[model samples]
Target chain A: MSNHELPRTEETRVKRLPEKQVFDRAALNALLDDAIVGHVAIVRDGKPLVLPVGIGRDGDTLLIHGSTGSGLFREIADGRPLTIAVTLLEGLVYARSAFESSMHYRSAVIQGSATLVEGEDKLTALGILTNHMMPGRWEEVRDTTKKELAATMVLRVPLDVVSVKISDKPVDEFEDDGDDRAIWAGILPLRTVAGAPIPSAMTPEGTPVSPSVIAQTIKLA
Target chain B: MSNHELPRTEETRVKRLPEKQVFDRAALNALLDDAIVGHVAIVRDGKPLVLPVGIGRDGDTLLIHGSTGSGLFREIADGRPLTIAVTLLEGLVYARSAFESSMHYRSAVIQGSATLVEGEDKLTALGILTNHMMPGRWEEVRDTTKKELAATMVLRVPLDVVSVKISDKPVDEFEDDGDDRAIWAGILPLRTVAGAPIPSAMTPEGTPVSPSVIAQTIKLA
Candidate 1:
């Protein structure tokens, strides 16, 4: 593998479809960048617990923030083993046979312990997260206050132990599989589209839409 | 709480935002019906592992299936503790301050040990899954073969231990919070839209699009 490829470790290896395993670090980064929400898993009270969280990738580390008063965030900040899974479903595949039918998706599962970001670095991480979710949002808004920073808990998860899987194969039909060739089979493409921005009721009349919102709407469209 | 409300147990209670907790069983069912994918988490070798799976809710049970050859599915079949999280991101909330910025979402977290489905009930569950993913698909497609049934592993997770959180609040702006009202603040709505179906190359030239595909496209639209 090239130096740019992710290491094939025991936990990071794809067991079912090895061919679908993506080793390129660039592919992993791209998937992380495209997806906005991630399901974060942690062992709580000797049982599995998973919750959805806003996610952003900063360099090789994944950033997720929660309230400082949150019990779950406290547990994650305590260095418990955690796993984050981000999946973007691209389309629904309709094969001739039900067994061959599946989804076209890009998913990444990251395994690591989170390190809490504090002091000045916390502000920078927050900015990265803001811009990641709403591009150009940081400059459009005011600076975060000290109290706001203290109330937020930003945790950084290294992208070291990660497994990326992508299923984007076109519809394949068996030549002699006895399925009806007349049965229409293909893909129904699905995508997340952004609608027009709706200004808040408190906003003064005729206040123009923010640049970040306009840019994001165009990008998502 | 009413008789139709879900039990608010220690594990199933919303920890961070108590007010956002949804105990209504119908709300839980509605969220499950609207979402297509769920991130399932299980503890393996003292660490957490999370993966994405297509999900369908049948009455009070959540159904998920995987290839029998998958090791992870085998682990889940053995009755290991599992947590499934399904989140629907509706919009991005642009609050007056960075601290208040959040996503409007309906998220459900179900924690339980999965029960393996076998025998004739497995076929019924498969039909439910097929129809859930593609409405009216079970009738249009050919029946699954015995070998195909044997190759698939279906698991049913009860909705007993569950927590549902909904963040559908309108953009909240503090009148005296000192952030610029001139900054466009509101929600940028987001949704999954299904595009027109593309027939496979193997499909007969004159084959018509399946009713399920057309219905699903309109429903998603």
Candidate 2:
């Protein structure tokens, strides 16, 4: 699991469009770190259920948390088989033909059963998630109370079985496809940017924006 | 299915955080339109498999496509039960405590079996998808040829069983909670913006940016 290259297993193999598959462990980690949200899928009564979840990466494991009362979270905490799909849409590629038009994206699919984090490890996992989401805010904010910790369920999924696919190149074209060059063909790059912070009603009138917010905005930009 | 409100089936009910559930059909459609990608979950060999797919909404149905040779696409075309989750991250909410810090997001979970679109309807579905993804480009690009159509598999799932959850409000605070008001608490708004277009090598020199690309950038901003 600590290797530089991701394991090539039958389930993780990219059978379709094999050229897009990425085996580098670094690439997988980058994708997980860049994307703040992911979709988790689990089976319930022989039917597939998927939902969006906030995610964080802690070394070779992915960290996600939910309320202890959530049914889906409980299923995952019980070690139900699950899959998490994280995708970052980079841009839209325009080609001369509609069939050739596509999007530039980096996506990773991870499959594994989750293990619930408890005791001291749970506190560390919570800190990792908090700082991962709001970089420097953990030290400024109050610590989690014992009640809050009991109500929260943190789960970790090992990143052993994973598949990564990246489509960041330009539009595809055949040499003799007879497509007109005059038609515009290019990429419209997309990015998620942070705007000015809006203070809540509870905040004091002269209070300055948190440093974490400023840092996050600049990082996204 | 054409009603103004979404049906509240047992499966579509929001068991957790019921306060965030939205039952309006228009909200669901709007969320689907605003998001260009979704994660589709399906059962493969009794295990959950999820992947990101380009999405489009045509009337009361959601359209998604993949290569005809894809095993997941084939399974979806065969009417396997699936769920598609589409989420838009609006901003990051900062609170006095880490437990209250969260993201402002709008998400919809749609569950149903897909039906394959064939013949003339498939062509229409393709156009719907293309334009939905890259607005106004379908009219400018060349039509899909027979060979290209044969290699594409488009599936449509009814917008019937759906669950929409939105968390856009400011931070939650309880009176006399002993949290300091001087600490900043607010929302760092987030938006997906588009940058200048980059022409592909095949594009002719001095070619103007496509109208669709400009429009999409403006729309995202």
Candidate 3:
């Protein structure tokens, strides 16, 4: 193998098509935190229900918040099982043949039923959620209210049911194909940038952007 | 109602939800196009499968792509029905209580099957895909090749079967809950910013960031 073996975890089991299985915790955590939203798939009323929603993560657990009133949210809070899917697209893998083209991606899927979290656990979960989105914003924000806590539903899915997969290189050509062209074949990495911050419209004129936001600028190493 | 009175096309019949049925082409398209990835939900062998993958928009239709060699991709390209879920998080809706706190969101689930688009249609589809991610990119970059075109597969799903649900206000309270303890209970808008472009390491020094990318600066207005 040209690349060193990726760190493996007992929590991570590789299937035969294992290019899609990841056993590294650090890699998985980065992928979850880097992603802004998640697609939650759950079986409701017998058919598959897949919906896109916001998600925040901390350590080995991921927090997904749905409208407290949503039927899907109610189902999970009532002890139904749900599967959380998260992905981060790194690049478009272009190949010599259309059939070979694939995406350079990192993804994880966690399967578990979500029950409602409350009391101190609920507040701590919110902090992790906030930090997952924009690192330092939580301390600047005030504490939530008891009523506010009661109105929102937070589902925590452990990292145990997680599977992370990655495909990072260019296409591997067939030995018999007689095709070589002027096209460039390499990774064109995708990244998210923080745009001009929109200060609360009520902020006094000339107020500098908050450090919590100023520190949020993320760039590749 | 002002923008979408009649459905856009024959396939795009609006399914009446208990409360979430409205039509705004601009809003709908923006939600789909601005997103870099989306949830692709399909069923196989009696089990539901939902995956987050790269998705692009073509006018009203949405396009999803993967390896022509993947069993799942082959199934989708072979005319099996599919579900594409696209979402946009507009604001963090803070309420007086935790249960009432939620996000102001826009999402749609397009139910349809894949039709392999080729030649002129495929080129148009690529343009839409490029512009969907980087607004001015297609015009700035080099042209696509016969080899590149042949290797990639684009599946178009009509915009007909769509659902757009949005909640854009503060949470409901007892009406007389003391305002004295209420924190800010309005929408705090979130935006995608365009940061300074990082040139590819292989790209020779002094090659300025592409104008197309410069013009596509992240602006939320």
Candidate 4:
């Protein structure tokens, strides 16, 4: 579904970017889907807190898991307003002048209130989150006990309020400042590359690398 | 040599981390000195904004560069509270339960008003910022023009309040869990690896790759 079709509220600002911005949702999703970790920002009693945490996406809803006791997750529920953004800076931007310098980034921001998914929804959400983190992991690993589920909190942020902003360009100066004398200015692409995956030491020696891990290499590429 | 020494100020919760936190003039300076980029968090009209910007360390002062026309930097020296934090996530903390999973991060949070610098300080700060991003190219690039400086803003955040919170354990849990399931859990280890550096086409032919690029391979290591 297109971004507009997702549930969006008035506070959603349709920020602008250069014309070169990408329009492909698949590419955007691929970037978000491949990573298992993200940085979450929230305001706690008037103070801003940013934490890196594990995250998962189930279709359109993003599942963020926290300790049942986390102050950040506890502060949300029902329909409180909040903002969660996940950004992967794909490349470094270099401009002749610092003013024009910008990053080639793919960032998805969700502005909405998250609600607790309970009962069967909670079970399914847990399954999805585990699978999102590792392919075949949910199936091979021990299932969560009832007590574990009761002690965990998962915040589900709907996808409709999400938007992606990107910027990528070669340096173009209004006039030549003779920077060719010493400086080399241009875009340098950056990307995450998977090295040899380390299996859990306790894992059986005969277990082959899962299909999910193999797929991510090309997915991020 | 700890974070406490950076010329900076304490947050309302200066007691949170305690001596485990650093708050010396030199501690803050060292933390800033070892790093090249700083994450500048500014409050614009009561909203918190975090941007990864170029920064330089000068004795006890931290320097950040931006455009004068940029509303964020323009408001920095206006006696508004701008929280400048520079952090490097050194390690990941894997816990038996996701709730206990945390990161070993070293961050410096300084609150204060910034003032514009002049004379040699400006030139020196600009030079450090330029070299911070790409080391060898600074001497090759033409110098900043007058109009550029007139349009640039540099805010100095003193290193007065800072600390390092770090956890590197594979899985910290209750004794029973650690003795049993903890054996099943271990860190996958996170590292950023630089792939083959693609040279810019503008680079003169036959110029081999520089050591600066070679050194980046282990940045995430």
Candidate 5:
């Protein structure tokens, strides 16, 4: 195994179609960096509740922060078992048969118990989250106040137990030897695009859009 | 309340910031219609598992289908509590303060028990799923055989206990009352864009792209 590859644990092993599983840490890092939102799963009242929250990665740890007033966050801060999933829909896979049709995606599921970061660590995690979503805005925005910090909960889940899956195989490979040569089988790639920035009404009449926002939109385009 | 408003039950009540909760059924329908994938939450061995699955709405019931070989689907088909969450991140809300920075999103969470659909209902549910992802292709693709249908599991979760949240509030309102008036605060709209279709290697050189695929690309653009 390469130096950056993540070790496969019992929980992280892909049981179904093991060929699709990816163990490279670089692949996992890229997936986490490209995604802005992740689904956080936790058991509440004997039922699983999946909540979408903004996510960020600080080195090897995945950080998730939410309002302390949220019931789900409060339950998650108790250091219970949780799973966070980030899935990017890359393309639509077209096939000759309905059964073989699927989506091309890269999904990373991290299962671990979260530990709440308090005091100064919480502030740093919040910074990481803000910077991940909108780069360079954290420096321009006002510093977080004591009251504001108290109102939030920042939890970190180490990338210890991770399962990554990338499904980009061509669907026509199954039909290359078959009788269906006329069928149109291929992929339609999809990606997130940023649109023009809309200044808020409260902003000064002549204030220009932030440099980071402009850069982001250009990168996306 | 309007007749189209969804009933607020104990399970569907928006506990955090009740004012942000939406009850309009039209809004709910629009969200489900626009989204192709949803994170389905279920408990396995006392831990919450969140799986992203293709979702489709057939009237009031939301259809979720997967391979029968999936262990998660097998557990869900046995009639257990499940929560399906669909979130669309519309824009990044930038504020003068880091604490107020957030994402504008439309999210709907439906909590209920799923029941397995068999025979004719399963085939119809599969059609709904396919049509939701790519309209008009279901008719063009090869018909689903009996063995193919048998290999898939279609589970229906009623939109009975649904909670919708739309966070479109302008974050600049906080800056207007605060001390930071020089900061640039605005929204960076985000959306998924479709790229040019790439035909499979086995496809004929002159074969045209499918009608549904062309329509989808145009719509996305």
Candidate 6:
């Protein structure tokens, strides 16, 4: 289901190509749910630092976890302003002109400070994050101990002040431009394919790939 | 050709898991060359702002182009310090425990200020960027005019201060942890596949798909 449209602030407005801006919260959520990783940005000293992070969507909030001793975790614990962006490149748009050529993609950018999750809520958030990365496997794995929870930092950033940009249209040629009819112009679709599972050598022989992993691959494909 | 190794600075040092750090310049270049999109971050109004950008590599530097009207372009034109990260998710690591589950990915982060290219360099940079995205399509398309170059902003960020992290190994279990022979632990490899090209409806009938597009699809697959 669809949630209410995301409330846009001055920071979330699409200043370029306003036509590509998407407002439906459901659309925003769909992008988040489909994506497995996001690029998180935070300013350290004066330079901007961007890192690719494993991400999970918990309803209206986004969950991210890391080692508490890591600098990123320490920065998140500070509750400073940060930006998390999830981008999925769908295809390569081949236009008649180099200037018009582009990619078909859906991107969501969330701007806010993340709150450190604690106690039982932290455990639940971690599980949600794990499940998001590898669906259905969470229940099969062993439970997280108190020490593990203590060493990990889980932060949740609400889905507020967000902007979504989607570019899916085919190449739009300029009427004034002259181009040869013999030249082919089109879209080359790009998809993430899940290859065969390679069981670790340490595992017992004859262990088959689980259905959940297969299902996840199918969904991504 | 392999360039000299990337000299790490206080900013680019991998503080968390030092084992995953990569210093080879060729390795860094390969990641940038293989990636089609990257997440770029720049500080605006004392807040971190990250966006997805189409990226290309020019020898030792990275090239990114956008509309001059875009705020991100303007910020890059201002010669401000920013970060660009290219991440390729290779696989999903499944471990016996939730805490140990992780992703196999290769990510490169470059921190520097972009210099706006002009005159002959501008056109060259644009061609390089376009060719990187769509290999053989540049020569087939109409030539870009002086007006088009003026309206677009092309920035070059040097790969001087860079950090690369790669996680490719399979799950490494803790020695003290008990094993469950029935549990599956392994790696699910992930790769981007290029599907059949869909020619634009406007394209003339009977036109064959170009060799460049076919080559690109094969490379990605």
Question: Arrange candidates by TM-score, highest first: which order?
Answer: 2, 6, 1, 5, 4, 3
Candidate 1 wrongly placed segments (more than 4 Å): A1-3, B1-3
Per-candidate TM equals 0.97, 0.98, 0.70, 0.74, 0.95, 0.97
Considering lDDT, where higher is better, how would the candidates rank from best to worst? 2, 1, 6, 5, 3, 4
What are the per-model numbers of colliding residue pairs? Answer: 0, 0, 18, 21, 0, 0
Cα lDDT of model 6 by residue, B1-221, tens digit: 53678887787899988899999888898899889999999998899999999998999999999999888889887999999999999999988888889989999988898999888999889889988987776777889877888888999998888999999987976644456657778899999989999998778888999776887887797
Task: Summarize candidate 3's per-residue lDDT along A1-221 as a digit string, tens digits.
Answer: 11223335543454424766756677777788777678877665555567776788765677887556677677767766666778766654433333343456788777666667777888888777765554555665456767667767788776666667877755554433233333333334554444454433233356555444454444221
Off by over 4 Å in 2: A177-179, B177-179
Q: Higher-TM-score candidate among 1 and 4?
A: 1
Q: What share of the true interface contacts does each candidate keep?
A: 0.81, 0.89, 0.13, 0.10, 0.80, 0.89
Candidate 4 residue lDDT tens string, B103-166:
4555566555578877667777777666555454445455677887777777677654444433
TM-score of predicted model 5?
0.95
Error of 1 at A52 (Å): 0.6
Q: Candidate 2 has which clashing residue pairs, if any?
A: none
Error of 5 at A75 (Å): 0.7
TM-score of chain B of 2: 0.97
Model 1, position A131, has a per-residue lDDT of 80
After the best TM-score superposition of candidate 6, give how far the Cα of residue B126 lies from its true spot, in angstroms: 1.1
Candidate 6 lDDT by residue in tens digits, A16-100: 9879999999889899988999999999897788999999999899999999989887997798999999999999998877888
> lDDT per residue, candidate 2, A1-221, as tens digits?
47899989897899988899999999999998888899999999999999999898999999999999999999999998999999999999988888888999999999999999999999899888887778888876778899989999999999999999999887887665465677788888899999889998888899988888887887788
Q: CA lDDT of each candidate?
A: 0.88, 0.90, 0.61, 0.56, 0.85, 0.88
Minimal lDDT window, size 10, model 2 chain A: A173-182
Interface DockQ of each model: 0.79, 0.84, 0.19, 0.24, 0.72, 0.84
TM-score, prediction 6: 0.97
Model 1 chain A lowest lDDT segment of ten: A172-181
Q: Native contacts recovered by candidate 5, as a share?
A: 0.80
Q: Judging by TM-score, tell me the better candidate of 4 and 6.
A: 6
Better of 5 and 6 by DockQ: 6
Candidate 1 CA-lDDT value: 0.88
